[model samples]
Target chain A: MALSADESSRLGELLTSRAEQVTQQWTEIIAGQLRGRLSQAELVRQVQELHRAMVDALGKGTVDLNGEEATELRAVLAEFSRGQARQGFSATETATGVFALKEALLAVLEVDQSIETLRDYVAFSTLIDQMGLFTFESFVRTRESLIADQAEQLLELSTPVVKLWEGVVAVPLVGTLDSARAQVVMERLLQTLVDTGSPYAIIDITGVPAVDTQVAQHILKTVVAARLMGADCIISGIRPQIAQTIVALGIEFGDIATKASLADALRHVLRLTGVETARRQPRREA
Target chain B: MERVPILKIGDILLVSIQVDMSDQTAVALQEDLAERIVETGCHGVIIDITALDIVDSFVGRMLSTIASISRVLDAETVVVGMRPAVAITLVELGLSLNGIRTALNVERGMELIAIERADEPYDERDDGPIPEPTASP
Candidate 1:
């Protein structure tokens, strides 16, 4: 509900004239809720800024919470919510900071019994409620994006392609192979294959926890993709249990090579490239 | 009027596809190469596609056909230097170029062809165990 022009002017005068009282009461309410989790000086400054913006909006006759006049107030609330979210404040706790203003304003407006003041007071309460919900929504959105960014970084970190030899590279996978991660693995492996022009790649899955049919299919798809780029893929680290699972599932890797360990796979690739690993002898009795 | 050139190197035929081939051009190349393979009696064919960016189903099918034709002529066909993007797109487009051998580059492709030719006729003496290399004791 919007406050009438006259009511808006009357409330605006009350808010600005009684600004100190409103800030005091609002700080007390929020400080009580936060219990010194945030410093008193910080809390007081935020309360004062919100109170001043609300008063300024009321004076400008901006009763609509989403109107152009409320832009500054919205931006302040968004920043506040984002900060609170990063500071480890719960959603309820962060939202209570806005809700507490309603109580503070009510206490200040109750000193008078005028009908116009009562109407403006209710409008103010509704505006604060909308603003509070907006802050909570912004907080949740920021946290979600932060988590998504970290998850992407983790995915990229876990799938590192190392050049094991002149014409060979290896991807040491160490986690669950979901469809998304599988796509990343496929893309990175293909790109690395082209960059290195390596004819051989070893996909070491020893660190991979387990492999079902779906995982086996992902591995096969990756191998086929690499082979399409002229690089043969050797899937190493086929544990006895994983081997049993593959056989039980009737999943055939066909011509794609499989190895029991990374070392054996490396040796196979080395032999394929015809680079024999010869050991040197010690000098005669030093 | 653009035609992919087929060069004869010893007993091997080298075809480097440099143009964006239309279906007609791809078919022409296939015909011309098959004729040249017979005329020259080449034992190996190397198709270098390093410059060809997009290998749609038409070009891909042409490659498979070329490989099949060369096989009938007692020659091995090796496709080499397929870009990563083209390979990925080909797979996504449901064309794996099955039965077609691929190599990293033309040199490797030639080596592959040489190996294939060297191993032909199945000599029993060639199958004997290789002697180990040992340093002087």
Candidate 2:
């Protein structure tokens, strides 16, 4: 129902005259609902700003929400939602802050015994409800994007390819070997191989918790890629358990070298690169 | 038809692919490389793909075929200087270029060929240190 200009002006005047009382009641309701989760100063400022925006929107008489009059209200709501997410407020709790304004306005309107006051009250309630839901949605979206960014950072940190020697590079695999991480592992290892002109690569999976058929296939595919790049790969840090798992799964590593430790892999690479170390004679015990 | 030039350095044949490769070009390269390997009696082949931006499956297969044919001719094949993107794309496309050797550059490729040709006790790192001669008294 369209609110007549007369009714809108009357409601606007009531909001202005009772601004202090309405804001006080609204602040109390929000503070009680939030229960000391947010700083009192911040809560008071946000509540006062929202109260003013709502009053202005009502005065404009364009409460269609999507109407231009609600633009300021939408901006305030979005900023409030983002702040709540940053402050660790749940969506429900944030929405409750907006909803509490309705209670405060109703209490202020209780003094007037007129049907027009009641009608104005209903229209304000609907507007606040829409604002509450919008805040909740914006809060959820902000939280989701934050989570995705952190996950990407963790993925990058997990995969690091380091050159171990003049002609050798090593990737010490940790955690589970999912396809996504496997692709990262392959890409970094191959790029390092090309960059350093290393003909030997060691993929150490000792930090990995378990090896299944899929993990084995990912490893084999990586080994094949290194070979194509002119580097022979050695699978290192293969614990006895992983060895048995490989056998049980019938996964053949073919001619690819397998070593029990990184040291052994390094020694093997050194030998391939023509680095022969001479041993010293043992000293007599004292 | 522009032919990707094959330059021979000593007993090694070097082919630097500086042009975007079409399927016909890759095929011609395979045939030309095989003929060059035979004519030069080269012991090693180094194909530098650092200049090529993309290596689709067709070119990837051609690389594998070149390695195999060179192997049959008794010449070790080393594909060198593959771009990072091409390597990732090739692996994603599920072609590992197995049966091929890779080097980071032409120099490393030459070193690999030298090592292969050296035929010294290459795999054995543990020959007991020669017994020190007894000190002259």
* Model 2 lDDT tens row, A60-108: 8754566888798888888999999988888888898889888888999
| Predicted model with the maximum DockQ | 1
Lowest lDDT sum, 10 consecutive residues, model 2 chain A, at A1-10
DockQ of 1: 0.52
Each candidate's B-chain TM-score, in sequence, is 0.85, 0.81
Reference-based lDDT, each prediction: 0.86, 0.84
Worst 10 residues of 2 chain B by lDDT: B120-129
**CAPRI level of candidate 2:** acceptable
Cα RMSD for candidates in order: 5.4, 6.0
Report per-candidate DockQ. Answer: 0.52, 0.49
Model 2, range B1-137, lDDT digits (tens) per residue? 77899999988999988888877888899899999988978888999998988888777778888889999998888888887777667776887776777777889889888888888555333447899999999
Candidate 1 residue A35 C-alpha distance from true site, Å: 6.2
TM-score of each: 0.87, 0.84
